[model samples]
Target: MSNFSSDGFDLDAISTQDNSDVIYEVGGGATVIQNEEPAMKEVEPSFNTSEHDQCEEFKKQGNEQFKIGNYLEAFDLYTEAIEACPSKFTGEEILRLKDEFDEKQRSEALQRSRLSEERRRKKEDEKKNGVSSSQPPESSKPQPFKTFELSQEDKNDKLAVYYCNRAATLQHMEKYNDALKDCDVSALLNPKYTKAFVRRSAAHERLEDTEAALKDAKAALELDPRNATIRKTVARLEKIEAERLEKLKEETMGKLKDLGNSLLGNFGLSLDNFQAVQDPKTGSYNIAFNQNK
Candidate 1:
């Protein structure tokens, strides 16, 4: 401190000139920061809980409109709900979260496995000791395994419901293709959602794609086996698919016969000269060439 000059210690002696840099001391060293531009701030992604509440309100309004047969109004409300839903994480943050989630899942699985093994060993020991237990005690009973999920998955599930409801409205308006597109998004968002497949089946049926409709109906039935409506739909689709295939078979056979007759006419023969007999057991056709005819 004694070696320091008074001019160096004087605050007024420092130049507050017209330069674009500010000099500051850190660890007895001077550092210059440019004053021409402000430092950029780092922005963090945040979920707005209020927006999720707003989305739920919009969905309820849409349901009200749907029940009253106002399909267009319902579609608008559902679309608004979909738009109000918060965006999910993406990029590196999502990747990091996914890794953490996977690790947790693996740990839970290992824990469950060890617990199951321990229970089995305990039961075996009790049996050897002549324990008179007809069934596992309440505490030993297998508890339900809860499915874990990420926050984004929860938002996506809500968004899926909105898309599915909108798709139903589109179906009511006879916009089958548009409904199909919406159902596609709904199913992609939540594969376990059965209604999306049901709505898609209806749309495909309206578009006269019996095969596709049957497939989706069957899928819906599998997802909700106890649903009477889904079961009925699957049955109806199966019958329609069978009839369609039969009609297609007849048309194909007719076309083949015509082609055969056209080619055989060059030799003064016809398809009538070649009789097709079907084997009742095997459902195979035999073509016998009758030259005498």
Candidate 2:
């Protein structure tokens, strides 16, 4: 052996030596130390937190605010929720599109039925004339009928609930017309929701639409017959509607009277020139023109 120092060898310096190109023989194969960087993992997006979750959280916060009668705060939170998850608030648009699609489908179905009937009539006529039917030359293949499908997002009940809640808040804030619009959206989204109907009725009442209020109240009653509040609302709305009709009738009669007076004034005559004598037995009135001043 060569002469070796009694002190420890310089192990730290040897260990710290750069081994970029160092190779070691192991099992008759060279194992090289690579200076390459370590492979990085491809990070996948986390599905744990999403817009839907944010929307739900906002909705919960809104509900809490609503319960405490902080309608403005509730409205803001609900609005934020709608912004976060627009799909949750697409009830009105979904209903409108569905109605449009249904109308189109009905129209197409009727058209097809009429076309088939016309073809059958033509075939009968041709048979009577002893003429064989000629097949029309086909052009490009017929395009497939387009199908309308409502995505899960569009049909969400939570959207209707949010609309209904917002409508209630609007009603509290005395924004009757806006409340009515939101109520309409909520009703369109979930027709069977009694609370929506009730809220809409209240909105209609505030807007002096007694007829509409009555209608909505009656609808709510129909949905929940045992709900005394709705029954009372129906009664109140009916009374209001009656009063409204009476007031309208009086206003119409007043207008007509004014018009008649104006026309009579133009003719150098007036309602004062007319006299009526009522006969109680006959329940009739005999009119006469007064020549006296």
Candidate 3:
């Protein structure tokens, strides 16, 4: 009675089909999803707490080795610990300790790198100049010069190396003042640093301070009497000094000659035959020459 099919209702007729897409109606309209979406696979995160424990365990082992004076063994263990957990073991307290470890490691690395670099540079320099760059004057800037903050623990040996090498760099720079300071440090850090003293001597020589250079060279010779290089340096410096003295004498004599000629008309004398005599005993000069004033 409510507007239904007045005569009859054809339910079978409304059961027709169309080849269009399937859409659902919700709030009076429908939207369609065309492509078939792929399904997602599940993945579990990798977090093995046991590995962290192992890392700690290895670090503890390294500490034990360090306590027992087994530095080499301690080094290996510490390396393993770092490899295991670089992130887990990061913190303020651990950072301080890690810095110590890092310093030690850096010290070792620097020694190796410096020596290898020196060899390479030396070979190249020798090839180019046909002489050993090592024989350069004390102020010669060192090849493979690099710097790093070093550990404070008995790092004298390590610092000695850097200071000595850097002194060479300073020498090459002609920064004699700074180079001498570095040499002092190197020598003080390691009294057995004979080369340091020898190098210091060379820098002094370059600065024309022969007295200090001779003293340093002597000290170096005392430490390592057999070093041919140091011996040669001493010989070269001695020769230089001798030549300097001789040249100085010649210069003084030339000045005296000029002075003697300049006295030609200074004193009015009847004849040009006047003579000046220097007494060998008194080092006093008695002059008799034509004077103008």
User: In model 1, what is the error at residue 210, expressed in angstroms?
Assistant: 1.1
lDDT of 1 at 25: 17
Candidate 1 vs candidate 3: which has greater TM-score?
Answer: 1
Say which prediction, candidate 1 or candidate 2, comes out ahead on lDDT: 1
Order the candidates by lDDT, highest first.
1, 2, 3
Best by lDDT: 1
Full-model lDDT, candidate 3: 0.53
Number of clashing pairs per prediction, in order: 0, 0, 15
Q: Write the per-residue lDDT of candidate 1 for residues 26-142, one digit (tens) a residue.
A: 112222222333266423234477987798789779866765667789899989988787646422343355567668877887897798888788889989999866875546455
- Candidate 2 residues lying further than 4 Å off, grouped into runs, are 1-56, 80-154, 272-293
Model 3: per-residue Cα lDDT over 1-116, one tens digit each: 11111011010111114322212111112212132332863232233788657755665575455444454565466456545642322223333554566687778777877877
TM-score of model 2 (CA atoms)? 0.54
lDDT of 2: 0.63
Q: Which residue pairs in candidate 1 have backbone atoms (N, alpha carbon, C) closer than 3 angstroms, thus clashing?
A: none
Model 3: weakest 10-residue lDDT segment is: 3-12
Q: Model 1: how far is 157 from its true place, Å?
A: 0.8
Which residue segments of model 3 deviate by more than 4 Å? Answer: 1-158, 172-174, 190-192, 208-214, 260-265, 268-293
After TM-score superposition, the amount by which residue 39's alpha carbon in candidate 1 deviates from its true location, in angstroms, is 46
